[model samples]
Every structure is written in structure tokens, then in C-alpha cells.
Target: MKIHMLAAATLAMLAAAGVHAAPPEQAPHARVLQLDSNSDGVIDRTEAAASTRLAARFDALDANGDGRLQREELRGARKGHGPRGGHRGGHRHAGIDALARLDTDGDGRISRGELEAANAAREARAGADPKRAARTGHRARPDLLAQFDAIDRNRDSLLSRGELRSWSEAQRPQREAEMQRRFDERFSAADLNGDGRLSRVEVDEKMPRIASRFAWLDENGDGVLERNELRPQRGR
Candidate 1:
């Protein structure tokens, strides 16, 4: 997919810059090669078939839907990365949206006073329904206030889009690493046989989400998952 190409391009650029002496064994190129079972240089339907995760997005990544995903196609798919913004299809930036909603003056910014007012309004709404309030805590996330305090770099008690964006960018890498760590831990725990792979039954019990797409992840139709199959498609 585009993610794969982006990873390859990144590694290639690093190599050109002398930042990467040689491709690492754990690199995306290695993983892609492993996934490309037929040695055809492309991830064909049969190959990608083992990954429900890939299959779900396969059509989008394929571009031509010819039952194959070329390197170029994967690169093209990386054009507009990240979640879709705005109030449309996918509300990936829900926190940002919530902040915008709190801009009571419609001035495209949220001040501490505005945030307080929003919080109070939410509390009052919850008070009107005690049961619902109890269930949801009738408040925003526990860290919301702390996040705002940190983002308000100047201590002006106000937040701009730029500050929020900066904070998000700063947290991205750490968040991604943590997610990968969690996935690795889960995968390791699920490998009951210590065979370095997970069978369908094991995944069904330990990682239902993956079990749902077992057929797609078993690239060679082996009915088992290799470490490469379970790993994130995005290169390391």
C-alpha cells in the first residue's frame, strides 16, 4: 500500500543521505518480501488475501482493482495521510472538534472562560439526567484540563489551532510507539505454542479482531499467522 512505499522511500532517502548504511533486517522491504509469497515483486490478491486488515483496505490501495497492488499504487495512496477532518465521514480529530464546539463566540478560538462555560453547560445537562450523568461522569476526559494547560504555552488561558496541532504532532511518535508495544505484547501473549506464529483458534481467543480477518492474514492459506503477518504493515 501507500504506507509501504512511503516507508521504502523514507529508507531510500535515508540511505542516500548516508543516514542509513544499509537496509535493516526488520525493514518494511523485508516484510514486504515475506508477504509477497510468489516472488512476483507485487502483493497479489492471493498474497494479500491472508490479511483481513489489508483486504479491508485492499480495494482502496489497489487503485485499479486488478487484484494486485503495485508499489506506485501504495505510494499514491499515502498522499492524504491521517484521519479525515471536519464533521464529515470520519471524525478522527474529535478532540479538536470538541474544542471548536466550545468556541462560544464563534471566533475560531477557545478561551478558558469559554471552556468553563461549556463544562458548566455539560454538567447542567447531565444534572437534568442523573443516571446518564453517573454513567458518563458528566465531564470531559480527566486529562482534558491538564492537556489544555500544557497547550496554553503562554499561560494566556487560551488555545489556538496552531498550539493544538503542535501538541498533537509532539505526541504522535510516542503514541505510535506505545501502540506498537501493546500490539507486540498481545501477539506474544497469544502465541500459546511458542511457535512464533498464531493459529486461527489462538487468535480467535486472544485477538478477536484479528480472528475476524484470519483468512486474509493467512497469506499462503496456511491457517496460521507468521510474525510478519501480525506486524503492522507500516514499515518500522
Candidate 2:
């Protein structure tokens, strides 16, 4: 009778604590599955190399220090904390995401006709539901449409995979320069002392994102970040 009573009490205690003997982890994400060549349910460094975005973040996302990215880590990333466990604003490959949206036929290329159709569809949807369009993060970019003729080098009215690649390559240096300029502007603003550098306190107060990466960015153990020491990561 005493043993039965103790078991019942323990079960109730466990229920209250929300402790389970074995909580099931969710299956790996579809993107992860596609690269999970070994079928072992997690992405290793070799498998991750194929994805530039994942490769750049692999070290940061490996929460267990086990060199393997599990579903929970990926989920955490989606929720915006997985990158070095920091509250930095969301990071996305906007160019890549935009291109994927443009390639609606899944044929790995975009034609003028397809582009028109996509624009028409987006306009119709936006007209029908202004709020939905305003809320969506993937709204069509007018800048790309404006440059369509210039990007179509062959006069074929189609954007081949290579053409897109070439355009992005051509734009890379300018984009990187712009990113650096913006970083400089922010750094200058945060440098309360006008010393051309940011101390920990300044970073914590003005730039929370840099605060999370202070130790890493503060090279030479100087306890502050110089302009050269704190550059934005490319393709972020």
C-alpha cells in the first residue's frame, strides 16, 4: 500500500513539473532533409558546405558544440536566436529569396513572360487585399523590374541563370561598399567619445547587435572595437 501511494505521489509530482522521460524532438526541416545525404537526420559540415548561408552560420548554429545541426537548433534559428544566441535583427539572403520568388516555374530561370505574370499576380493580390500585401515580406521589388532590360544582355527578354549571376557579381562590390558605409555611419553615431571606436558600454547602449558579438569583434583584446575590427558580414 505504501509503495502504491509513493508511485502515485511521484507521478503527480512529475505531472506538475512537466517532466517527461522522453520528449520527442521534431523531425528535421525539409531544407535540412534535402541536404542530409547520410539520412542520419542532422546536417554535418560536409553536407552544409553546399549552402553558402548555412555554411556561414554552421559554427554559430551548432548549439551543442557537437558539430551537428539538429532540428531544434534550426527551429531556434527561425525564431531569431540561433545565431550566436544573440538578439540581432533578422538576417536573410534577400537577393536569393527574391530570385527564388521570381523563378516561379521551378525551372531555375526567369523569363520576361514569367516576370510579367508574377508582377500581375502580385498586383492583383495587393489590390484585392492591401493589408495582406503590406504585411507580406516578399512583395515584388520594383527596382528589379526597372532594370530588367539592362539585365537582359542577350536581348532575349529572358533572365538566364548566368545573367542573374553576372548581375549579382557586378553589384557585389558596390553593395559591399554601401554596407561598409552604413556600418561606418552607425559606428560613428555610437562612438559617444568621438574616438573613432566603440567601447563596450557605447555598443551595449547604442548597438545591441554589436554588443552580442563584442568579444569576438574586439580583436587584440583591447576591450573596444575599431572601425576595421567591426565590419558587417557580407551577404548577411
Candidate 3:
């Protein structure tokens, strides 16, 4: 009788553990590493120094050297440093791609007006259907709007070099938060009961990009992201 009681208690603990899972895999893709540009393996003072290098990265990726990022620059069609925009025959290479919906005009060109749009589009795209608005959740969180305001400090109706430069101080922190938020927001939306937990069914709905990125967030080994699973420390 004593042994059976102990076994039942252990099984119950395991059952609870099985309920609230963690982010699936491991660290995000080499996006952060590649951002270093210098190939330092670890992103040092350069990337975190400010919006300077980042702005320059954005500029360089702009291809035309325009102050803004555009859809054309993001298209898999353009000729870039590596192999022109995509995987051709299992090619091993590096590349860049920004949010296409930010091409406000549908013209595929991202002007200063489109930078924030790109970021927003990226958040939505992570767990969203490209055909629908990304904000389709049970209760709208002010996070999205707050994100816009943070980047659009001047509120002049557009993002500018001055604004982006001023924002470099927030670059690293924002990256940390944004990366995590992108993961939680996806799970939160699918958690219909608002129980702060997710099952495999909800987990299966994850988008390709989300699935590939931040698998490490699932630390609990469950199929969902629980409150405790978000305990990662954020920083520059």
C-alpha cells in the first residue's frame, strides 16, 4: 500500500509537469550571431554599441544604399553577396530578409514610413497567417501599440534616421524582449482558455518561422510555454 501511494504521487507530479511545457528546441537561429557582421562568434560592443552599426547593416542590406529597406531588397529575387536570395539545390549560405508587408505600397520598397511596419509585420508573421491581421487574439494587448510608440518616439508619422539612431540605445534590449515576446505572443494567442498553458494541439499551429526560432524557450520539455518557462534573463 505504501509503495502504491508513492508511485501515484510521483505520477501526479509527472502529469503536472507534462501539462505546462516549455519552448521546444534551443537557441534561436544564427540571426543574432550574424548580426555581428565582424564574424566574431559573440556579438560584442560593435552590435550593441548603438544603432550606428545596425543602421549600417540595414543600409548595406538595402542593396541600393537607400536610407530605407524595401520589399525588393527582401525579395528572394535580388542578387546579393551570397547566392541571390534563396536556397538553390541545398545551398549553404547566409542572407537577409525583412518583413515584406512593410512594403506599404505593395511596391516592395520600404521607406522610413515602413520600418516599424516591417517590425510589426514580423511579429505578426511569426505565428500569424499572412492573409490575416496578426492582432487577431482573444484580448488585444497594448504591447503591439507600445512597441510602435517606442520606435516612433517623434510621432511624426514616419520613422527616420534620427529616430533610429536615437533608438540604438534600445537596440539590444528590444531585441531580447522582442525575441521573447514573439514567442509568448504566439502561444498566448493559441491558449484559448487563457490558462497560461498550451497543449500539443495548440503547439502544432505554430508557424514555420516561430517553430524554427526560439526552440530553447521551451525549457520544461513540455509542448507549451508556461509562465515559468519565460524566466530567461534579458539584457544588451
Which one is best on TM-score? 2
Highest-scoring model, lDDT: 2
TM-score: model 2 vs. ground truth = 0.55
Clashing residue pairs in candidate 3 are 21-222, 22-218, 23-217, 23-218, 25-215, 26-216, 70-110, 71-108
Candidate with more favorable, higher lDDT: 1 or 2: 2
TM-score of each: 0.47, 0.55, 0.27
Q: Using lDDT as the measure, name the better of candidate 2 and candidate 3.
A: 2
Tens digits of per-residue lDDT for model 2 on 127-203?
A: 89876555432244454567778778998877776676566556656554554464466678789999888899997
* Candidate 1 per-residue lDDT over residues 43-115, each given as its tens digit: 6543554454443444445422234555544443234233433422222233344345567798887787776
Candidate 1 displacement at residue 233 in angstroms? 3.6
In candidate 2, the residue pairs with backbone N, CA or C atoms under 3 Å apart (3 or more residues apart, or in different chains) clash, namely none
The clash count of every prediction, one per candidate, is 8, 0, 8
Candidate 2 backbone clash number: 0
The TM-score-based order of candidates, best leading, equals: 2, 1, 3
Cα lDDT for residue 231, model 3? 34
- For candidate 3, the 10 contiguous residues with the lowest summed lDDT are 89-98
Reference-based lDDT, residue 104, model 2: 74
